[model samples]
Target: MSFKITIQPSGHTFPAAADDSILEGALAHGLLLPYSCRNGACGVCKGRILAGNVDYGEYQDTTLTHAEKAAGMALFCCAKPLSDLVIESHEVSRAQEIPVKMLPCRVEKMQKVADDVMVLWLKLPANERLQFLAGQYIDILQKDDKPRSFSLANAPHDDGLLELHVRHIPGGTFTEQVFTRMRERDILRIKGPLGTFFLREDNDRPIIFVASGTGFAPVKAIIEHALKIGFQREMHFYWGVRKVSDLYMLDKIGEWEKLGIRFTPVVSDEAWHGRTGFVHDAVLQDFSDLSAYAVYACGAPVMVQAAHRDFSAQRGLQDDAFFSDMFTFAPKQ
Candidate 1:
């Protein structure tokens, strides 16, 4: 049977199915509740069950002590509602709300999403999860002198496994391995949830997201997160690639279009049926004034710089409204 749950203070409420933990139900309904390990090991998800009964599922002894439990506290990540519940908890509204972590993960899956892009899924050890704000990049720690960094391509609410989009750069050893020899079950060390390019949720302005080549990685993360939270702000996403082949993940973008997200795929190197020329130019051609909008751009430095410069100077967008992350080549091994 399904039960209802109400979060205190915010007064946000959602229905929870019998098999779903409180956290799962909340996330599925676009609620960004504060959580970490998802498994009950981390007390970050602990909160008072102000009213109603719950099946506090499996948890670590030290995490939810008897005293805390006796006081009606429960780990939302593992707790299943036994009846309608009123919970005292708050949403995570900032990047600092979650802790960064250094973890080793096994390459669980990989897909050649584009001619030069490999989408990888990294699985943490059992009961382990990495909490991160959307749009953050992670440094892949290798034995090489310098580590490589890649933006996470998955949304925070769906963080069972970490996802990254890696571009195959010629002469880049790590990327070369990823394209050529990296195998499933390979272990990789990562330091992350780094960078400050996440979506600014507090603002109510419409959003324009620009992505070039592989820079779409972080933008994908941010867009998915924004969509999951049920944000209704006007969203215009422009992803520019050299050729049609370079534009991967169209399926995901197409899904967004169904939800009213304006999607413009700009192809620079080839003639296409869709919009053409520089991605930023497409934005300029469409929107005469951007001052009222927030623009997040990622990918090649050239594109990010161009978007930052033009969107502010020509389109009247505020400098602060233009957020960007430039993809730079990692130091060679």
Candidate 2:
């Protein structure tokens, strides 16, 4: 049976079926309730059940102590409704609302998709999952060196294995190890679900995604999430690379095109028989005005800067309408 669930203060209400976790129901309604480790290992999703009964599904005893339970608290991640409910919980409307986590993960698999790009799949420990929005990144921790940040390529819905596309850089320490020595079952520490470079879902504005090199990682995440949620906004995706060989995931791109999302692959430096030159300029060439589009740009710092300057000043895109994440490379040592 389905029951009505109401949020205190906000007074927002949504329907929750008997089998759906409180978090699941809220998310299905586009109501962002704070959550982490949706498996109930983390207490980040704990909140007061101000009214009505709940199943309070399986969870670690320590995460939801008897004292807290008696005080009307329940772990929303594991709790399922028994009747209509009113819950006292804050919504996660901003990136900062999600908790950051540091956890150990195993390299479950690795595939070299291109000459310089290696896709790594990381598996979190049992009962632990990192909660994050699409397009966020994680920092791979190192014992004797600084952490290396990589964008999560998989959307939140398909987060069983954290996907990361790591590009090899000449003289780079970590990437050199990844390309030369890292193997499956290798243990690694990661901290995140970080960054603000995510989709702004509040509006119905058409989106123009500009990605370069491995910047395609985060853009892939956002686009996948958008598609999963059946976002009806018009989307145009342009991916740029140094050469034709630098472009990977053509099969997946082909699938997305069939679903109505426009895809343009731009190759700079060396070209075949497709779009060439700077990726941003291709957008300029296609659209006479971008005043109504929301542009999300990622990749090299120079390309991001150029897109930001030209799109707003030349193409009439509003300054606030453009969002970007500049991929900075490690310095050669």
Candidate 3:
């Protein structure tokens, strides 16, 4: 049996099956509610349960505190509606317009960009075209039906191809396959255009793009899309890495710098000759006032969390002005 779920403010309604999470149902029907880390680790999917009962499955309490539950808040990522429901959330404008599809993609190329990072380019079916914003991601369907998500490194304008930066995780089920068993022309099933971390072209605020390691993938997409659209707002990109070699696409960024985009490379590990500090610190040092700036941060959970806390609390950036995607790894057995 399925239940009717209605969203406030926008009044968007969709069907939610008993076996599916709210987010799963909403996305299955092409309804876009703001979300990230659909596993309920990130609070991006938190929303108020205006009416109806929901059974929230296994989720981090930190993402949904008891107090939040008492206040009628639930993580839509894991919430299963038990009855007709009404929710309060800000609908993602672009996400609502884009059609999400499941398509067969063939591995076209896999080039190692760094010691551990490989740039995987997949070719979409010739007859099926994918239209996704710069910072969105796709989920690779696995044997047991488990899906692993990776952000697209290239903008939609790139055409008929999807680029993803895959970092080799020692025993990662998917990454290991991509590096060893996976080959060119191998077909894989993918579903996508997920996540709400796209470019906010409507806002004229200056942008602060922060990335660490392969996290630069999506940030690169956002910047490239911005440039392609002729965005005049000032853009500053800060990339943090342990050593010079870690900045794999340094030359590409250098080319972008010549086009008038401000680029800063930061190294956190000591024994570095260049800027030695956190990437966000570099931003703070340069701009004491960020009241009018919007920050887009992606990378390790630690870096993304730190930037959100520091930027909002100390640097005068408004809460909504700071957007982030915290890349996480599944627990080891």
* Best-performing candidate as measured by lDDT: 2
Residue 185 lDDT (model 3): 94
Score each candidate by Cα lDDT.
Answer: 0.88, 0.90, 0.83
Query: Which runs of model 1 end up more than 4 angstroms from their true locations?
Result: 331-333
**What global local distance difference test value does model 1 have?**
0.88
lDDT of model 3, residue 14: 86
Measured by C-alpha RMSD in angstroms, how accurate is candidate 2? 2.8
Steric collisions counted per model = 0, 0, 0
Task: List the candidates ranked by TM-score, beginning with the highest.
Answer: 1, 2, 3
- For model 1, residues 79-177, the per-residue Cα lDDT tens digits are 999999999998876767767788889999999988899999999988777778789888998896587989898988888889999999999989999
Residue range with the least summed lDDT across 10 consecutive positions in model 2: 324-333
* Model 3 stretches with alpha carbons more than 4 Å out: 1-93, 330-333
**Model 1: lDDT of residue 296:** 92
Span of ten consecutive residues with least summed lDDT in model 1: 324-333
| Predicted model with the maximum TM-score | 1
Write one digit per residue (lDDT tens) for candidate 3, span 84-153. 9999987666765666778889999889888888998999764455667779888888887778888899
